[model samples]
Target: MTGNLWTAREIAQQPDVWRTLATSLDADKPRIDAFLAPLLAKEDLRIVLTGAGTSAFAGQILAPGLSRTLRRRIDAVATTDLVSNPREYLAEDVPTLLVSFARSGDSPESLAAVELAEEVLSECHHLVLTCNPDGQLYRNTAGEHSLALLMPEGTNDRGFAMTSSVTSMMLAALTVLGANPDVTLLADVAADALPDLAKRARVLAEDGADRFVYLGSGPLTGLARESALKLLELTAGRVVSYFDSSLGFRHGPKSVLNPATVALVYLSNDPYTRRYDLDIARELRADLPEGQVITIGCRDDAEEETWSFPGLGHLPDATVAPVLLLAAQHVALATSRALGLDPDNPFPGHEVNRVVKGVTIHALDE
Candidate 1:
């Protein structure tokens, strides 16, 4: 295995990066609070989280739990959607907060999404979470109506796949969205589990399973999507990976499992939702080969086969989702290496890009 890949280093640095991010964001809380206080007070404000690709999935992972906790309709509108079809989503009469997430902060759709929000929405405010300070989102958001939270340096991952960038931004969103999750404990759990996780991921990748499935409920559903995308990206599409909610998988997607398939079910912490997740996990374990089906989540007295986040059982699902991703990130990186691909730049031909290109943003019609 190559030890010097930026992807591996980026993946391994997440726990420490998260701790640094926590300290810095906490120090700036007063200003962040000042910026958010008045907007959160408004009952009519529509909160939309927008980003492209991996950044968009970050919003999907955060929206359900945040909306429930905040008692507002928070939508994870992707920048692709916001750019391609702004008229369908943006409302003129409603005050809206467009929370944009970006790793590079240079994507054409990202900038176009912000401009479209400003044009279409009557009362629009911007909250830009980006890793690059020099990116357009960070530089152009100096207006009174916007607040840009630039993550500590090194979070802008140099890898082709987003590793540190995704987790850092998710932690930032949790803190900014008014949840006081134990950031230290989150990092601690990841730190404790990573070494073993890397070993397990290596075994899994080299284990001859060419297909993978990730399933979860609610916030974990999006985490499943993020995990699937990570695997697909890091492997350069050499191995197949798919995602679905636990209940939804039974409909038609369960066929993804075969002798060469490995299925991982992400159990939710919510008691009722956990039942549905367990139902699928048990069924998959029964149907698939032993060790091919695994469960991931938080629990105090977790079963032997389950991968539990040791001390984080009580955190909200959204707050806990980011940490759960470390497992998948490792698996993806390991699989990429096992397949003899460069995790840092998987596509030698540039069929895919770290930051998407060739997307022409068209003007919105009146």
Candidate 2:
């Protein structure tokens, strides 16, 4: 029972967890570069970013930014879609790069999607980012054409939800696509700032906003989705949650806004994206809701109190504000505890595990 105690304190102190995971990417760069070289060289390369559930959200966070950075046609597609209609998702005419993000590569949909891609596409390359090295995705790619980047150990959380693992895999994808992110610097900043973020998040969680809406543009939208899910899952649905892109929120979703709701917007550093994000913030500020609208970003000249991180230049745009997510996690944990829900096992009757369960993988016909 010695190592069995899974407390937030312990989870927070796991040996430069962020840095270790970040540094591991150094070895992956060359492999990634080699794999991506020919694909990038092609006049028309279609990059499809995919996964299931949270993994799928990782793609949502990265695709837009990656498209802008690499100047390639990148799209985020859920493996669930690939499972249902493989041909529709896979393109055969042009060279393609498939980036699959998974906490546990064993997900039936994850494995099947890979099989489907190879079967349906004449030319396809793969980049697999996962925590489980022994998972099918890693095992299947041995001596093959793909590259699999395994995250630092213990990142494969044993709890019912993914915390560190999700962030780690997302970082891996960002590193491979480009950025050449400095893991050590980003990790140091995150680790140092977490304690304070945790304290503030607890206060917010305790305030008990009836409805929570997360807003962000580009890659941060994925972070917003993950943030909303953490609160929803950790609180066992005690708090209702939703997410939307910054500009898109005004179309209709803004109707949900009221005095009793908490709206969190993740701002971008890019002027174009930030302009839209700030516009929404201005509207929210003008409405004067009784509830709070918190903005997390690197640049914060807005009138409201903003949470800004000073040394986040080493991270990619999608990753820069992730420390803000640590705050969200803390809020979820503290709020769940305050509501008398166990943070470790929020859903008592739910059988979901850290890796996942009850998934049946079928044999692909050769």
Task: Give the clash count for model 1.
Answer: 0
Candidate 2 lDDT over residue span 199-250, tens digit each: 8777887787757888988888887888888878777888888899998888
- Cα RMSD for candidate 1? 1.6
**Clash-forming residue pairs, model 2:** none
Which run of 10 residues does model 2 get worst, by summed lDDT?
Answer: 1-10
lDDT of the structure predicted as candidate 2 = 0.74
Q: Could you tell me how far off, in angstroms, the CA of residue 326 lies in candidate 1 after the best superposition?
A: 0.2
The local lDDT score (0 to 100) that residue 82 gets in candidate 2 is: 84
Error of 1 at 61 (Å): 0.5
lDDT of 1 by residue, 183-247 (tens): 89999999999898998889888886789999999999999999999999988898899999999
Position 260, candidate 2: lDDT:
82
Q: Report clashes for each candidate as comma-separated counts.
A: 0, 0
Full-model lDDT for every candidate = 0.89, 0.74
